[model samples]
Target: MLSNILLITAVGLGSFRSVQSQSTPSICDNSTLLIDSRQVLTTAQECTAVAGDIVIQYASDYPATIEFPNLESIDGSFLSINFDEDIRVTRLSAPKLKSVTADVYISRWVNLTTINMPVLTTINRVRLNNLPSLTSANFLSTLESIENNYEVTNTSLKEITNDKLPFAVFVEIFDNKELEKFELKGLKNASYNVALRRNKPGVEVSLPALKEVFYFEFQRISSLEIPELERVIGHFVVNDSTVESLEAPKLQNVGLWYDPSISITNNRGLVIQNSGDSESLSFPVLEAVQLDLVIRNNSALRDISFPMLRRVTGNIGLEGTFESVRLPELDRVGGIFSLGNDEAGFNCGDLQAFKTNGTIRGEFSCPRYQELPTRSSSIGESEKEIKDWLNWASPSTGFESFRSMGAVAFAIGISTILLVL
Candidate 1:
């Protein structure tokens, strides 16, 4: 009995000492914990899990390196932002962090250099913006799944290639001046837009497994490869880009959404091809474009050919300097079919049959087939030209037909000499 009491007393004393060591308040024990100074950060070093948000921002004299060695999870968001531009932290590391239930938004940190979240795997959303000094982030390589969206802008990272991520609702990766290559090898579809704009000039993009998207827009890109893309529901725009050859070998239907011109609605019209700088633009097996097929301003393409295209429900506008156009199987166009070129020998005689045969349901105008203007003069210019040409013409029977009333008219008389015999 004596030995049992002594052992119990020793165990109780050890537990009491352990509780006394943690005298400071836990940062995770509240709904929101703000870490503004080194002392505040030190007080949270013992916490293993944060039930609420962890906001770290608006501090100038921060430690050189901030780390959470024991933090495992955060039910809320992880935000680090400052409007006054005073955050001077160099590295933000959570080596053991694996999940964040909410977004991980880190923005406007002018002096941050590295984001060393090595084992982070899942999150809701991530927006890393205006981190000019951030060179690399280890979490991007290990992330396999995400929820809402992923957006990154104004960073110095060179490449973002992920073969693990399969799907995302919205993605915007732009204004990263040093990004060189972006490849999403496993992404099968994007239910919404996947836009990459204003990135590096010569960035190479490869979405080999993408089959469909709502709207796919690429700008300032040099090389793009989408070998398996089949459908674009909204718009497929490649503007201000320098891609040499664009071959959508499997793309069949473009603008398969609700046609805006069908009803008196507020939706915008669908456009398939807006602008590109490709030398060869070919959609070999495409059969239909539900709405407008605006293939214009493709300056370097020598030909606009869709050999198997059958119908265009909306307008078809093709403006380029092409040597020839080959749309052999086109049967109908619901709206205007406007085709113009700057080539000398470009002809449109064969296309006139579509209009006469009623294959085109709306207005049609091809090269050399448009009707000339019947009334080609203004009223004022016509009167001036007519009066100048007919020098002997008298003014109209009006009082002030002439503009200058002070001028007088001169008459020449013909004299006849009579001889008396």
Candidate 2:
């Protein structure tokens, strides 16, 4: 009986010693909490509310689960850098995390599989990189806004769909090899650029209601569908892909009023044919180009028609062997009109009329000509004589001469005069 009582007392002392050894003053008063590999975090309750930054990194003997149920807000950054190759953190959950006032950078977690923050809604910036084994990120459905930049690169994330993050300055998703589907259905505008490059083949992109962006570029995407996109204030370039079809029905302007250019090149299998109509590769409402317009190196391109085009302030460069080219309503071109094609059926008369009207400011070149032919004046005339003749045959003189002759005689006389001039 005495031995049993002594054993119970000893057990109580040991429990008290363990608690005393692991206890410390609350770290909430400090602005930064650095959870390093050397210190073993027994429970997440030790540091509940951090006034500033929280860095959880390099845990050599990391726990399997880390939960911060009471963390409501982080006033500064939350950065996690897990560089330990053998650390085993399977899940990180913050059930009540509502906002991060600054950046959130989660990178290089080589073995982390999932991140769960269900009610997180606001963040300033987010960058996720080099997490190869991470497959899922959950509880971010309530996220509404990212103020600056959101970039995800070199991860194993298969898909991302964020409806509430409607506006961002720059969004770049690249080098995610297993990413197959990306849907930002509710995204309305991007202030700067949205670049999706070097992703997996056959991946689908759906941005249904996106209306405007400054710059939009796609490289090596399988298919693109932005049905309601109306304008791009900068360049819109699609290159180095096998995208079979591109549909941006409402896109009207490419560049801003200052700088304008559009390039759709090297998409060999792209076909822009309407289903029930005969229009193929058509920009129906594109009315202006303030700078260069280049359409080249597309092998499967057969037809191009710009019906409502009224003016181009720069060069109009057309290459490759297109079957038909139609610009019926093109009224003015401020620079060169160049055509480089092996096929010889394109008529140069319309361009000649533009040249004669002084609409094209630069030379026009085609496959058949080293240079366009000059005026048919064999005998050399001095510059002064040409000026004198132009002055003598003014509009007033010509009108007075026509009034003095009979109608039939006047027609014959004008014809003879034109031939002599």
- Segments in model 1 whose C-alpha atoms lie over 4 Å from true places: 1-25, 258-277, 368-421
Q: What lDDT does the true structure give each of the candidates?
A: 0.67, 0.60
Clashing pairs in 1: none
Best by lDDT: 1
Model 2 / residue 64 / CA error / Å: 4.1
> For residues 1-421, could you state the per-residue lDDT of candidate 2 as single tens digits?
9999999999999999888655533564457766665343444345445688877877657677766667777888878875777777777777788888887788888777788888888989888887887787764346788888778887778897787778888878888889887777777898887878887765678788799887677766666778888777655666665565555667676654421122322211112221222123445666655444555555655555665555554456666555555655565554466656664454445445555555555677764333222232333432332233223321110111111112111000000000011
List TM-score per model, in order: 0.78, 0.70
Specify the highest-TM-score model's number: 1
lDDT by residue for model 1 (296-322), tens? 667776666666676665556666665
User: What is the model-wide C-alpha lDDT for candidate 1?
Assistant: 0.67
TM-score, predicted candidate 1 vs. hidden true structure = 0.78
Residue pairs with clashing backbones, model 2: 118-139
Candidate 2: TM-score? 0.70
